[model samples]
Target: MESQELEFHTAEEDAGLRLDVWLTEKLSDVTRSFVQKLIEDKHVLVDGSAVKSGFKLKKGMTVRVRIPEPVSAELKPQDIPLDVVYEDADIIVINKQKDMVVHPAAGNWDGTLVNALLNHCGDSLSDINGVIRPGIVHRIDKDTSGLLVVAKNNAAHLRLSDMLKRHEIVRTYEAIVDGVIREESGRIDAPIGRHPTNRLKMAVTFRNAKEAITHYTVVRRYPSHTWVRLKLETGRTHQIRVHMAYIGHPVTGDPLYGKKCSLMDTGGQVLHARFLEFMHPTTGQFMHFEAPLPDYFTRLVDLLESRSSGG
Candidate 1:
């Protein structure tokens, strides 16, 4: 793989933003974690000086970034079954199951959505998401189950990514939170950045964080929990989980952001990407697809229904 030297001039509007945060806003295709990796690798420099992700930007500062091509792993096509929701010549949408990593990474080198796409689409998927993620346009976390769309070609990928950046693509999820939400609806408009102490986690920060918005409605209230439907105005990694946790109602079974498993009873985070709506890349028609709540979510509903009915 080769590296490209890229220079980005900060816009006047982007003045006073943190370097890493500014870069993340500019480069929406690549993830924040990947950008942070580049920064830690000394692949990014502000005015030719190596700095941390917290380095604040000044107007007219020329930011140089060395983006190396993702290392191509020898990923063979796997015959994993996919819960495909919709498909056309331009894009394919799938109901991704929980615990399934979207792309090949450190420990998980197979059974990824890429491997399945390679098998299902043959060689038709786009290479825009790098070698590891051949067709993926967006991603949900490993523990978050939901609908995701993959582009079949570069044109589709570019169009879909552009729509996402403009917040034209609507993504919604349903999550079982730890506490009952007293309000019928609410919004979380916090800026999210990497954790100041833990590099692996993300948190809401007054500085160095990107603008995030989450709108949620309480669908069902339990004695100790609430099943909330979430609509994302901005898609950040762990956006729903992090925002919910920040608002004092972490997703039930979320180990990273919430208290221990003793506080809740579920396999993992009870969050599901339930619906996706966007314009068709080729046809220009509005499209919407939904993945039914998984079995575990159904089980929770059954239990909650019983309790709510005074069973």
Candidate 2:
């Protein structure tokens, strides 16, 4: 693989912005931390001179960035168990367990759903997402248990990706959040992007943000907690968690976006992808799948119910 170089001229509106921030806005796929790393490695230059990531840009200043090719590594197969709900020649739907990563990334090199799929499906899985993420069409957070569909071939992958982009695939999630939601149903329409100061977190912002919408309905309400059913109109990263937190009802046990709660000792956010509906890529038939909540989630809900009933 060959390295790619990108050049950009700072516009009047972009002047006085930090170099890394400018680049992050210009390169939507890359992160600010990665841009800073490129600056530290001297791969980013201002007018052919190496500059710090925080250097303020001037109007008409030329910025050049050199992006090295990603190193390709052979993914090893793992014998991790999978709760496969449906399988066919074109795709497979799995009820992913909590705490299980969907694919291998920086710190996680093995024991992911991709690795498990490699062993389970052999070479039948799609390679559209590269070897590191074979057959993976979409992802849920590592701690968020849910249902996901994996493509078995390139054609299937392309169709699924297109359907997801058009918002034709139906995905519904169930979560328990802090505080009682007074509204019977509501929609959160906000743009989401990387947090300006905290790069590790996503926030609702208009700057270089993508449109995200989440529709939620109250399923049940306890004294202090509320269970909600959510449907995504746009699948932005951390959309559900960020939106729920933005509305002041963060998901219970969500360490990143919500306060700590002892009622659910599940070690992660109380969120689950309960239902999925989509058209099969090969057969063109409508398909639907549902996953039952894990014992931990059910138990916590029961506890909340008991408390609400004064038991």
Candidate 3:
């Protein structure tokens, strides 16, 4: 179980607004479902009195919330190796390797980023992500290699998550696609949600999907493949892969979305998260970090250059 106390001071303009809406704006990181649960459980109070989601806010009223401890699964910390690129009291930037799962789930309980982080940070990490994912602010897929920023405390987690929502945190990726892309640069703005029949996969669903945007630039091209740099305008699950596949240029060796290729004999698609930039959660300083291309990506580049030169 966990205990938390939150205070919200209402503004004049926010007076008479529903309590749920007020809390949503104040605690932007926690989803509405979570906030509503707090309210329903009588954990949320207006001026020391329990209230419902529809409770009206008063100009000078303060909303206090006390969340009870959550029942979470057991997750033991392991001494897994980590490539820590940056670290401070509030956050850590890791150059995560390919094939390492970012968090624990079914069948992946021990060898995860959370396990490694627990070993690294000891008891200093926050429990905002529950017992399993103590201080995780965001995530990158297991097969995607490169820089990822993790929070160290609840304050830092909330700050970094807010920055992400505001698009202040920037991430860039380099991908090798299966087909030649003629365009020098372009943007793909579409909606993404769970696949209709396949619930495990995400697709560009026309309805009930959230807005997703990706910008791409052709870096180099071979006879049958193209190297591209991608910038995210919105972060959706499997966004880059799904957006590329939607445009008919899925990443090479993308077993889930693209044709299988042995260009560099890599196990997965030739995609890498190359760079990340964001404001520090506590210090408010601008931080930028980059990860060098893995061997397979570099080898693919060499092959492209050699073919371009008729080698």
Local accuracy by lDDT, each model: 0.83, 0.87, 0.81
* TM-score against native, each model: 0.76, 0.77, 0.75
Using TM-score as the measure, the top candidate is: 2
The residue-by-residue lDDT of candidate 1 on 234-309, one tens digit each, is 9888788789999999988775677434433565688999989988988889898988899878887778777778
The worst-scoring run of ten residues by lDDT in candidate 2 lies at: 24-33
Better of 1 and 3 by lDDT: 1
Identify the runs in model 3 with alpha carbons over 4 angstroms from their true place: 1-73
Tell me which of candidates 2 and 3 scores higher on TM-score: 2
Candidate 2 vs. true structure, TM-score:
0.77
Off by over 4 Å in 2: 1-73
- Model 3 lDDT per residue over 49-93, tens place: 988899887798877777666545588888989999999888889
The global Cα lDDT (0 to 1) of model 3 is 0.81
Q: Could you give me the TM-score of model 1 versus the true structure?
A: 0.76
Location of the lowest summed lDDT over 10 successive residues in candidate 3:
24-33
Residue 29 lDDT, candidate 3, scale 0-100: 28
